[model samples]
Target: MSRIAVVTLVLHFYMAITVSTFANQTGRPNVLVIMVDDLGYGDLASFGAKDMRTPHIDRLMSEGMRFNEFYANCCVCSPTRAALLSGRYPEMVGIPGVVRTQPESNYGYLTPDSVMLPELFQKAGYHTTLIGKWHLGLAKPNRPNQRGFDEFLGFLGDMMDDYWTHLRLGNNYMRRNEEVIDPEGHATDLFTQWSIQSLEKREADGKPFFQYLAYNAPHFPIQPPEDWHERVKAREKNADPARVKNIAFVEHLDDGIGQVLSALDKLGLSENTIVVFTSDNGGKMKYGASNGALRSDKTHVYEGGIKVPTCVRWPGKIRAGQETSFTALTMDILPTLGDLCGVPLETEIEGRSFKPVLLEGKQAAFTEPVFHMWLQNGTKEAMREGDWKLVRDNPGDPFELYNLKNDPFEKVDLANEQPERLERMVRVLMVHMEKAQKIPWKRPEAQANVNH
Candidate 1:
C-alpha cells in the first residue's frame, strides 16, 4: 500500500481505540452491596481476627482494600441502614434509632423525601433489587419498594425468628414488595437464592443491576445449621458450650455469604461488578464476639460501637491486595457506588465518594465531619468530630473528650488536661448539630446549659 493509504488506516484505528477506551471508562458497572448484621470489625481474618476462617470475606479484602477506620454511623441496625441508603444522616430521616413495633407506623420513620441510592440507580436505567433485612422503615411511604427498589424480598424488622421456614408472624413475616409469606429454608439461604435469581434475571434482561443483600445472620438467639454446629463443635473440641454454639452460628452465616459470592463468580459478573462487604455495627460482645481490643461494645460512642469491618472489591478498577486506614463511614457507600455506577445522587448527601482512593489506592480526604447521637426521645448522648469524640451520659454530666488518634479505645479521659482542645471540639459538634437541625435532648437543665 502507498504511504498516504497506510497513514489514513493508522488514523482510523487510533480514533477507534480512543472511543472504545472512553466507553469502557464511562460504562456503568453492576453493584452488589452486602451488609452483615451486627458483624464486628475484628470478625474477619483479613481484619486481623485469627478466630474465624472467613475465606470468602477474606478473598474480597485480598482482591480489594480493607478500611481500618470505617464507621457504621449508628450502633444499631435501622438507623445505620437509613444513613447507608440515603447517604445522609439517619437523624435527618427521623430514624434516630431502630424501627421497632408490631404494626409499623410512620412516626419517626424514613420519609419519601429521602431519596435512596437504589432509586438513583433505577432512574439511571439500572434494575434494583434487595434480598435481605430492610429495617429502615416498615410503614407506608417508607418501604423499600416505595423508596426506588424495583423489587424487594426481605423482612422489615431488625431481627427474625428461626433460620428455618419463616420467623415472625403478622407483619413480622418475610415480605415481597407488600405481601407477607413464608419462605422455605433459612433466611440466610433464602436471601442468597433470591439474590442469585435476581442476578440471572438481570443477565437475561440485558440491563445493569444493583443488588442489596443485607443478611440478618448471627444476631440474637444464635442458631446454626446442624452441619455447622457439628463442625464448630469439632473445632472447639471441649470448649465452652455456649461459645461453641455462637461460633457455629457465625460460621453458618459465613457459609451463606459464600454461596452468594460463589454465584457471582460463577455468573462471570465478578469483573464488571463492584461488591462491598460491611456491617451495621459492632458485634454483641456479650456473646463472645471479639472487637479486636477495642474498649467497650455496642450502645456506646466508643470505637467498638461505631467502627466496623469494611472491604470493597471492584475488579480491574481497584487494585488487589491493598489495605487502607483512610477513615470512612457507612453513609459513604451510597455516594461511592453512585460514582462507580454512573448514578448521580439526588439527595443532598453528607457522605462523599471515595472513588479516587478506591480506584487509585491513594490517600483521600474527608471534608464533612462525622456526627453521632443516641437519644431515646430527644436527647444527644454522643458526638464525634474528626479524631476527637465526646461522650455524655445525661444532661447533667460533663462532656468526656478523647483523641481517637491517641486513644481509639477511649480508655483515657483528656478533658481536664486538654480543656482548650475539648472546648474547640465541643464548638464543632454544636455547630454541626445546629446545622443538621438536630433538636437537643429535652431537659430543663440542658436548655439552660445550651443557652449559657
Candidate 2:
C-alpha cells in the first residue's frame, strides 16, 4: 500500500531468486561409482542367489532402482572400463580387450585425446578421485592422476596374483598417485578404508566429489579370509568347496561395501550422494560363479558374459525399491552422470543418457543397436537391437539369432528362421567393425618401445 513496502517486497523477491540460483549451482550431487570385477548376475541374495549373502548390496538395491537389462560394453575388463569412462565404444578408444602389464599380452591402449568421465566432472568443479583398480593404463597420459582424478590410491595392473600380497607378476602396481606403495592387509579392506578416508577428506574440503571405488573380488584365485570361508562351509554343508570359497569371498566384499555405505550415512552425505553399484562383466562360472539362467559365462558373447547387475541409489531423487528392464550399456553411465550433475559434454560420444529412466521410473526407448566385441579367444562378438540378438561366438562362425524377449536363455536358435533379420543385423555389425578397424588398439610403436 505504501512506496517503502512495495520496494521492500521487490528487493526480497530478487534476493530469493539469487539464493535459489546459487543453491542450484553449488548443490550438485556427489557421485560414488562402485564397480566390482567379474561378479555374476545370480551371485547376490537380492539378484536370486540362494547360497550367497550380500546384505549391503541388497540393501542398496532396495533403496534405489535396479536395471535388469544392464550390460557391459564388452565381455572383458579393460574394454568395458574404457567404455565406461570415455563414453564411447571400447574399440573406438583403442581398447577392445584386456590391458595387461606385459607388453606382448596387452590388448588395449587408451588414447591421450579421449576425454574421460572424471575430466568432465573436474571441469564442472567436482573433485575426482579413483580409489581402486586402475585397469585402463599403468603409465602416463592414461593413469588416473594423469587423466583427470585429483587422487589415485589403488592397484594399477589388471589383476593381483594374491590379494594379500598385492603383487602382479612379482611387481607392485599399487600406487598413491604415481608413487608405488606396498600396503598391508587384504586388497578389499584396504580399498574400502581408502575410500572412506577420501570421503572424509573431501567432506572437510566442502566440495562435491566423483569417486570411482573399484574392487577386484570374487575373481580368480577366489581368496576369502579364513574365517569367512569357514563360516560359509559351516552354513552350507552340502555345497562344494569351491562354491563355499566364492560365496565367502563375495560376502566379505559385501561387508566392505556396507562399511563404505555406513560411512556415508554417518558423514551425513547419503541424502546428496548418488551411489552406483555394478560389475565390469559377468561371473566366471568355473570359479563357482552363477549367472542365473543366462547362457554361457564370462569371455563369451552371451547374456551371462555381457549382462551385469546394475543399480543406482540417490535418496529423495530416485524412488526406492524400483526396477526397470531398460536395455542399457555401461557407456551410458557417463552421459547419464553428466546429465544428472548438470555437466555438459562438449565432445561427441556414443553413449546416450538414461536420466529419464532413473527419475521417471520408465523404460527409455532406445532403438540404437548395441554391439559387443572381445578380441581374445577367437574374437567373440555380438549385437542386440530391441529384443533380437545376433551372436557370433568366434571368428568365421555363423551368427546365431535369438529373440531375447522370448528365449532369454538362448535355448533355441532362430538363425535359419529369421534369415532376413540376421542379414540386416550382420550388415550393421560389419559397419561397426569397419569403424573400429580405423582405431589402433595397441600402443603406438614408440610408446610400446618406451614401456618395454
Candidate 3:
C-alpha cells in the first residue's frame, strides 16, 4: 500500500475508536415512563381485551416483557403516584389517598422531605421532564418542579372535569412549568405533542432524559373525540354506549403513545431508550372498563383495583416478547430505574429493584409482604404475602383471606377456613398501620384546625 493510504487508514481507525469511547462514556439509556390514569388490567388487546383495540400498546407489549402481576401502590391516584415517585409506600410519604383541590376533601399531603424519582435522575446527570398529569399536589412545595422535575407541563389535579377544558371542579389545573396556560386540544393529544417535543429537544441536546408521561385519559367523563367515538361505534355496533366511549378513549390514547414511540424511532433513540408503560390503577367498572378475570374494580382492595398492566422495553438489553409473573409494585420502578441507569439511591427507600427479573427471567420476589391502601370514603386495605392475600373492603367490613395461587379472582373467601393464617396476616397489617400512623397523612395545618 502507498504511504498516504496507510496513514489515512490509521487515522480512520483512530477516529472510530474515539467516537466509540465517547458513546460508551455518555450513552446512558433515556428512560420514558408512560403512566396512564385508571387503565384497566384487560384494557390492552394483548392483555385479554377482545373488544378493545389498543394496537400501539399491543405493539409495545409485543416488543417488551409483559408483567402479569404488577401492582400500583394504591387503588387511588395520588397515593400510587406518590409511591411511584418517592420509592416508598404511599403512607410513608404522607400520601394515603387522593390529593384534591378542596382541603376538606383532600385526604393526603405530599411531604417536602420525600425524595422523588426525578430528583435522583437529576443527580445522575439526566434532564428530567414530566408531561401529563401531576396529581400529587395542586400547590407549591409539592408541585412537580418543586419535587425535582426539571420541567413540568400537565394537569395539577386529581382528575379533569373535562378533557378539553383541562379543569377540575371548574378550576384550571393545566400548567407549563408552573405557569397556568390554556392550551387548545384534547389532554391526550397535548401531552403527546409535548412529550414528542421533549424527545426532539433531548435528541438535539444529546442528554439522557427521564420523561414521565402521565396521561389522565379514560379516567372519568369518558370522552373520546367524536370521530374516534364514531369509529369505535361503527366497528362495535353491538357494544354498549358506555363501553364504546371507553374503548374509543383508550384507543385514541394508544395512538398518542404510538406517536411518541414513533418519534423515538425516528430520532434514532429507540435502541438507547427504556420505555415502561403502566397505569396508576385498575379501571373503573362503572365507566365501562374491564379488568379481565380480576374481581371488583377501582377503589376496592381486590385484584382488579391494584393489579395493573405493566410492560418494559429496552432493545438489546431486556428480552422482547417475554412474560413474567414475578409480582412487583409501582414503588419498585424507581429503584429499578436507578439500577438500569447506574444511579444509586441516596437515601433508604422501601422499593426493591426488579432489575434481575427484567434482564434475566429470574423471580424477583418481595421479601416483605406487599400492601395496598385507599383511605378515601372509608379505609380499605389489602396485603399480599406470597400467594395468600388479606383484604378489607371498608372500615367495618370483615377481613377476607384468599390464596391467590388457588383463587386468582378472589371467588372463594378462606378467612374462616384458615383462621390461623388470617389471624397472623391481620396482626402483620395492624403493625404496618401502627407505624404508618406517625407519617401524618393530613397536612399539619389541617390537623391543627380540626374544629374548623
Candidate 4:
C-alpha cells in the first residue's frame, strides 16, 4: 500500500467522526470524475500506451476495473462532455459539435432545458464543484455556476491556445466561478492544484463532494513543460521528437493525476470516493497522438475518433484488477452515477445505467443502438448495433457497413456484402435523426445555419 493509503486507513476513524458531525447521507459515496481532452483509447499504460508511462492511472486500473470497449459519445470535445453530464445524446442536449467562442465557427450550445449531473448531486446532499475545463457554454445562461455547480473554478470556453496563457483565440476563458482568473502555470497543473484545494476544503467541511476535474492537456498545441519533454526524449530515445512532446504532455497530466489521487488519500476520502477516469475523445492525428492502430482520428467517425480509454475505482466497494468488455458510453455515466450513489433519477434520460456491471460484473444490458455524429467536416454520422457499424462520412454518399467483430480496424467494407445489416443500421440512424430534429443543436440564430 502507498504511504498515503496507509495514512488514509489510519484516518478512517476521524473521517467517521467528521461524517457524524454533519447532515450527511449514511453511505453515499463521494464522486471524483477525471476527464482529459483529446486523449486516445490507447494513450495510457493501462490502456496499451507504448510510448508513454501513466503509472498513476495504471494504479487506478489495477485497483479497480479497466473498460475494454468503452466509447465517447462524440468524436469531439464539447459534445462528448455534454453527453457525459446530461445522460443523453449530445444533439438531444443541443451540443452536437465543438462549442467555440466565435459564433460563426461554433457548432453547438448547451440547451437550457438540460438538467446536469452536478445539480443532481447537489440535491442529493453532495457539494458540487467543477475544477477544470467547462467547454459547454461561454454565455451567462449556460455558465458552470448557472448550469448547476455550486463552485466553478475553471476555463469557461473551449480549448486553450497556450496552456499557460489559458486563452483561446486570444480571449481569456479561465475563471474562478464568475470572476475571470489569470493563473500562472500549465493548464494541467492549475486544474490539479484547484482540485487539491477543493478536496482540502470539502474534506474539512465533512460533506460528500462531487468533483468534475477536467483537464485540457494533450489537446492541441502539444505544449509540455521543457523538462517533461526532455525526460520523455531521454527515456524514449528512438521516438520522434514531436511524438516525444505528446508523450511528455500526457505524462505530466498523469503526474497531476497522481497528486490528485494522493490528495484523496491524504484527505481520507480514497476508500469511499468513486473515481471515473476517461477522455472526451480520441487524439488529433495531426498531433503526435497514436490511436493504437485504430483508423482515422479525432473529428472522424472511425473507431479511433470515438473510442477512448475509461476506468473506474472505488476501494473495497468495487472489484479490482479486472477488465470488462462492457459497451459503455460517456452518456451512461450520469445514470450510472445516479444508480451507484442511490440518487433518484427524476429526469427523462436516454442513458441506461451500468451500475450492475460495475458491482456484480453483470454484462451491460443496454440494447439501444449507439450513435456518434459530427457535423463539422460534413454530415458525418455513425450508428452501432452490437458489433455492426454503419458510417456515412459525407452528404450524397451511400452509407458503409463494417462488422467491428470481424474488422476492428475497419479494413474491410461490408456495405455490399451485408446489405441486410446495412439497411437495418440505416433505419436505426434515421430513427435517431428523427428524434434529433426535435431538439435544437445550436442557438436559435445558429440553428438554422448548418455547416454543410
Candidate 5:
C-alpha cells in the first residue's frame, strides 16, 4: 500500500479511539438512592438476620459490595439525613437533632445554603426527583424544591400517619412540592409508583436522573397490612403480637421495594442505573428488630443504634456477589455518586469515594478513620474515632471508653486500663469537634438548680 493510504487508515483508527473515550466520559449514569428508615445492621440475610426475610435487599447485597462498618452520622433521622445530603458533618449543618415540630425561623432546616446531591446532579444535566418521606424540614424555606430537587413527591415532616390514613402535619396528604392532598393508595405503594413514573418520564426525555427513594416505613407507628402481619405471625409463633405487626410492616415495605426493582428491570434501566439500599439508623429493638451481634437500639451510640444495613448494585460496573468488612459512612454516598456521574464537587466533601472498592474489589482504599459524634442540645453525648469510642453524659462526667474492634457490642469498658489511649482519643475528638464547629455544652436549668 502507498504511504499516504496507510497514514489515512492510522488516523481514522486514532480518531475512533478518541471518540469512544469521549463518549464513555460524557455518558451521565442514573443514580437511585434507596434509603430505608430505622433498619438495623442485622436486618438482612446477607447481614446475618436469621428469621425475617429481606430476600430482595439481600439480592442487592449478593450483587454488590456490602460494608460492615457503615454508619449513619446520627442514631436518629433528621441529623443523619442532613449529613448525607450536604456531605458535611451534622454539627456543621446546625441540625443538632430531629426536627419534630415546626420551629421558629431561626431554627435549622434544610435550606438553599445546603448543596444537595440532587442539586449537583441537576446542574450537571440530570433530572432530580424524590419520592418518599422528606423529614428534613416542613417550613416554608426548607422544602425539597427549595433545597435542590426539581420534582418532589413526599411528606415534609419527621413522621407521618398510618399507610391507610396517610396523615402528615395533622392530615392525610401527599405534597407535590409545598402543596398537600390525600393520595389514592398506601405510602409505600405511592412512593414506588411515583418513582416508576418519574423514571419513565426521564427516560422518555432522554435525560439521566438522580432519584432519592426515602421510605418512612419500619420506623414507628408499626402497623402493616393485615395479611402481611398474619404471614409473619404464623412464621414466628412465639413473636409478640405488636412486634409481629412491625415485622409485617417491614415485609410490606420490602414488597414495595420489590415493585421498584421490578420496574427498573422491566424498563431496562437496571443495567445503566445504580441502585443503593440502606437505612437511616438502627432498628427498634422493642419492635423485634435483630441488631445481630450488636447491643442496644436506636438513640444510643452503640453499634445497634448507628450501624445500619447497606447495599449497592450497579450492573456491569460494580462487581456482583461481594461483601467486605471495610468501614464506611452515609456521608460517602454523595461523593460516590458525584464521582460516578462526573459532578464536580463545589466544596470539600467529607465522605470518601468507595468506587474503587465497588468496581475493582480493592479493600485498602477504605482504611480512613470515620469520625462520629451525637450531640443534642449542645452536649457531646457520644464520640467515636476509629476503634475507640467514648460516651459521656455531661461536661463534668468522665469519658467511658470502649475498644469497638475488640468488643463490637460495646459490652466491655477498658477506660481504666488504657489511660494513654483514652487521652489520645479525647484529644483527637476535641480537635474534630472544634473543626466541625460543635457548640459547647450549656447546662440545663434543672442541672444548675441541682448544682446550687
Candidate 6:
C-alpha cells in the first residue's frame, strides 16, 4: 500500500514484457498449490506484519513473484475454490456462495459440466491429487474423484467445529477416498505430512504431479497446538487473547508449510516445481485478524474481504523477489496453469492467464476489469474495472464506487461523482449476474430446504 511499493510494482511489470515467458518453455514443472482458509492480506511477515513470524510462507514471496493486488474471486471459501479451479467466477459455475454440508445452508454446487484445473493437467499426463478440504460437494457427482482429482484424502465439509475431531455438527467428514476414516492429528499437521508423502510418491513414480494442498487453519475454532499457543504467550507476554491465538495458529500453519517446502527440497523437486501459496479470502477483522490498511474483512467485497496475499515460486521459471500489481483473480489460476503446462482447456472460462505478466513482465491490462461478487443469499457484490471498484453490502442496496488507486483503503465514496464509471461496472456485473440463471445451483429435491 506504500507509494514506493506501488511504484516498484508497476515498473516490475512494465519492464517484464521484454523478457521471455515460461509458457513456451520445456519441462513442465510440478504444480503444488497451497491454499489456506481466511488468511488476511497482512497476515504474512513479508506483507509488513511486525507481530508474527511466518518465515516459510514469507520465503515463498521472496523466492518468487508476489502479487500485490491479487483478489480472491469471492470473500468466502467454496466460491473462491470453485473459481480458482474452474478458471471462472463462482456464480458462472452455479456457486454464488459457500457450499455448506447441510443442504439448507449450502449456497453453491460445482456445475457437472465445467472443466477444472486438475482435468487439464490430467489430460497432459499429470497425476493429480487433493489432500485437504474438498468442500465443492458432499456427495456423488461433485466429489474430488468425480471432478478429475485422481485422489482425495481430507475432510469434505465447510469448516470443522473441532480440528481434532474433523467434524461438522457431529458428523464425521474425514475421508481417504470414499472411506470415512478418522485422521489422527491436527488438521494442519496431517495435511502437511500428506503433502510430503505425496511428493515422495511422485518421486518414486517419476510422474509430473499437481497436488492441491488446501488447509483449513487459523480460520475459526482458532486452534493451535498447545505448545505453539503457550510459546506465543510466552514470547509476546500479555498480548491480546485473540491476537495470541491467531498468531499461534497461523504460525503453526507456517511451520507446517516449512515442512512441506523442506520435503520438496529433500526430494530434489524444488527447482522443477511451481509452488503457489494464497488464501481463499482475507481474514475476518472481528476475529483477531488484520487486513492491514484495507477497508473491511471476509464476506464483503471490500479490499480486505477479497484481496489476498498471493505468491508463485518456480526456481528457474519465475525470478526471485519480483512483485506485480496485476489485478488477477482466483479464477485466473486455471488458464495460467493450463498455458504454463501446455495443457489447454476445452471448456470456456472467464479467467485470463497472466503468463505474459509472470514470464515477460508484461502488465495485465483488462478491457473489462475482473469481478468480485458474492450473492450468498444476496449479501454482497463488487466489480473492478482497472482501479475503479463498485461494491454493495446487501440486496437492493445502493452501490458505492471507489477509485482504488487513490484510496486503497476504500475511504472515499466516489459513487456520486463517478456516475459513469459506476454505471459501466454495474452493467458488466449485471451481465454476469444474468448468466447465473442458466445453471441450477442445487438439486430440485433440496429446493425445499434452501430458502435462498
Among these predictions, the greatest TM-score belongs to 3
- TM per candidate: 0.88, 0.93, 0.95, 0.93, 0.87, 0.92
lDDT of 6 by residue, 1-452 (tens): 99999999998887664332442255577899999999989888999888889999999999989999898999999999999899988888878888886777778877778888888899899999999998888888888888889988898888999999888999998888888998788999999999898899999987899999999997898999999999999998977999888999999999999999999999978988888889999999777888998988998888999999998888877889899987788998888888887786898889988888888777647666677777566658888887788888778899999888899999999999988878878898888777776677875567656655
| lDDT of prediction 1 | 0.77
Clashes of 1: 2
Look at candidate 3 and give me any clashing residue pairs.
none
Per-candidate Cα lDDT values, in order, are 0.77, 0.92, 0.91, 0.87, 0.76, 0.87
Cα deviation in Å at residue 325, candidate 1? 0.7
CA RMSD of all predictions: 6.3, 5.0, 2.4, 4.6, 6.5, 9.1
Counted clashes in each candidate structure: 2, 0, 0, 0, 0, 4
- Poorest lDDT segment (10 consecutive residues) of candidate 6: 17-26
Identify the candidate with maximal lDDT: 2
lDDT of 3 by residue, 1-452 (tens): 99999999999999988975686577788999999999999888999899988888998888989999999998878899998898999999889898888888888888768888999999889999999998888777889998889999989888889998888888998899979999999999999999999999999999899999999997998999999999999999999899999999999999999999999999988988999999999999999899988998888889999999999999888899999999999999999999998987987899999999899979657879988988876789999999999999889889999999989999999999999999999999999987887787776688888637
Per-residue lDDT of 293 in model 1: 85
Evaluated at residue 297, the lDDT of candidate 1 is 63
Model 4, residue 71: what's the lDDT?
Answer: 92
**lDDT, candidate 4, 171-264, per-residue tens:** 8888889998898998899999999999999999878889999999889899999999888889999987778899999999999999999999
Error at 245, model 6, angstroms: 0.3
lDDT of 1 by residue, 293-407 (tens): 8866666667787788888998778898888888888888999888877787776878888888898877556755578765454445566666777876445578898888888
Q: Rank the candidates by TM-score, best first.
A: 3, 2, 4, 6, 1, 5
Q: What is the lDDT of residue 2 in candidate 3?
A: 100
Residue 139, candidate 1: C-alpha displacement in angstroms: 2.2
- Looking at model 2, residue 391 earns an lDDT score of 97
